[model samples]
Target chain A: QKEVEQDPGPLSVPEGAIVSLNCTYSNSAFQYFMWYRQYSRKGPELLMYTYSSGNKEDGRFTAQVDKSSKYISLFIRDSQPSDSATYLCAMRDAQGGSEKLVFGKGTKLTVNP
Target chain B: GAGVSQSPRYKVAKRGQDVALRCDPISGHVSLFWYQQALGQGPEFLTYFQNEAQLDKSGLPSDRFFAERPEGSVSTLKIQRTQQEDSAVYLCASSPDGNTEAFFGQGTRLTVV
Candidate 1:
């Protein structure tokens, strides 16, 4: 089984709607969870990062991780057309450092105006 | 400061040919990483470098894949005898340290036909 699993969502939402993206991992050792946004033809950009199981809010985005469930989520509030892109979840064990990020297949999102 | 930068934004090579992709990490970053992203898939770990030292390379798919960070500032990933399966986007990222957030490059899209 892949260490990380995410829905390959081509999820479509209207502008101003709320968007929620999620991922699950089997590795209990994972301590750092991150969310990344990738536009077509571009590399992923860091969106949200959280250490361990907790919630972190940044601007219009909120990242939540439940270590107990090995699940993590990213919620985008008041989404806009510019927000359409692929969202990816990545994680690593606390001891693994920044070099060993394991990533889940990204969820594609399209926000129509 | 600039984010990570990669050269040859796009490459198309015939099967059995060799290809070399380059990455310039953010200045002074202590950690560098390489990842491969196939179509519709998230990025997968390839190799890592801490300054001039190659720390972990277990993620590389085969012996044909090689990466080097000779000066600790710029890194290169070379694929010898590329196969069709080698077609993917090669992404490079760097962080200030083992625990810091990583910044990614625009990535080099490689196609082995």
Candidate 2:
């Protein structure tokens, strides 16, 4: 199986809605999980990063990881039009493995005003 | 530079023509990486570099693809006899350390026709 798998979603949500993006990985060695936002013509920008299992919150965004299930998720509360973009889930192995990140096919989000 | 920078934001080359893409990472960053992003897909790891030493290149598709960071700052990815399949957005990212969050460049969009 591909290392990381994410649904390619062109999900449309109204303003002030709650949005959730998720990814699954088959590699149990992956220890670093990250979420990135990418606009139409720009590169991916790091958003949330977490290590191991548990939850991390930053402003209106929250990241959760479940090592046992090998699943990771990003939740956006009160998502706005500005949040309309592609969301990419990326992970890396423990330090000293491979520094290069493994990414999932991004989910395109369109938060309409 | 303030962030990772990449040259030739957009490039169009005829099939079989070689192409060279450049990346200027953030100063003092120890880890550098190259990734390929195709339409509707997330970026895929291509290679990784530590200073002037190329640590991992197993992600490269084939021998026709090569990358180098001769000076430990400026790097180049060269695709020899580029094919249509080689057309994709090439991205460069860097982190202060090998195990931290990374910053990405605007990316070099290569279109091989």
Candidate 3:
């Protein structure tokens, strides 16, 4: 099975809508979860990161992780056109140093005005 | 520079030709990583450097691919013989330390004919 899996959604939503992006992973050793936003011709940019199974909120974005279920999610409230980009889920092992990140196929989101 | 910088924002190379991509990571970052991103896929690990020492290279697809960070800050990824399959965006990232969040640069879009 792929280490990380995500739906490559060309999801379109109207502005001010609530958007949820999720990812599932097969690796039990993944301890750090991260969400990245990538615009066309640009590299992925770190949006949020969480280490434990819980919820973290930053402005209009929230990140949730469930270690037991091996699932993670990013919730964007009041989505904006600026948020239209590819959202990628990434995870890293518990190794303190020399760690590598495993990524999922990103979901593309478009917020129409 | 304040952020990671990758040169040659885009490149087109003939098949079987050699290509060398450069990455200048953020100053003082202890870890540097290289990744390849296809059109619709997330970034895939390529290689890593902890200072001038190459600690992990298992992610490299073949022996034809090599990366180096001679001074522990500036790094380069060299592809000996480019193939059509090698057409992808080469991304470079750096972190203050092994366990810290990483910052990525705008990738180099490579097109191998």
Predicted candidate 2 versus true structure: per-residue lDDT over B42-95, tens digit per residue = 999999999989999998999999999998999999999999999899999998
Interface RMSD values for all candidates: 1.6, 0.8, 1.0
Question: Which lDDT tens digits does candidate 2 get at residues A4-106?
Answer: 9999988999999999999999999898899999999999999999989999999999999999999999999999999999999999888565788999999
Worst 10 residues of 2 chain A by lDDT: A92-101
lDDT values, one for every candidate: 0.94, 0.94, 0.94
Best first by DockQ, ranked? 2, 3, 1
When summed lDDT is taken over every stretch of 10 residues in candidate 3 chain B, the lowest stretch is B95-104
Model 2's chain B yields a TM-score of: 0.97
Candidate 3 residue pairs that clash:
none
Q: For each of the candidates, what fraction of the native contacts does it recover?
A: 0.74, 0.80, 0.76
TM-score of 1: 0.98
Give the per-residue lDDT digits (tens) of candidate 1, residues A4-44.
Answer: 99999899999999999999999999988999999999989
**Tens digits of lDDT, candidate 3, A1-113:** 79999999999999999999999999898999999999988888999999979999999999999999999999999999999999999999986455788999999999999
TM-score of each: 0.98, 0.98, 0.98
Please give the clash total of every predicted structure, in order: 0, 0, 0
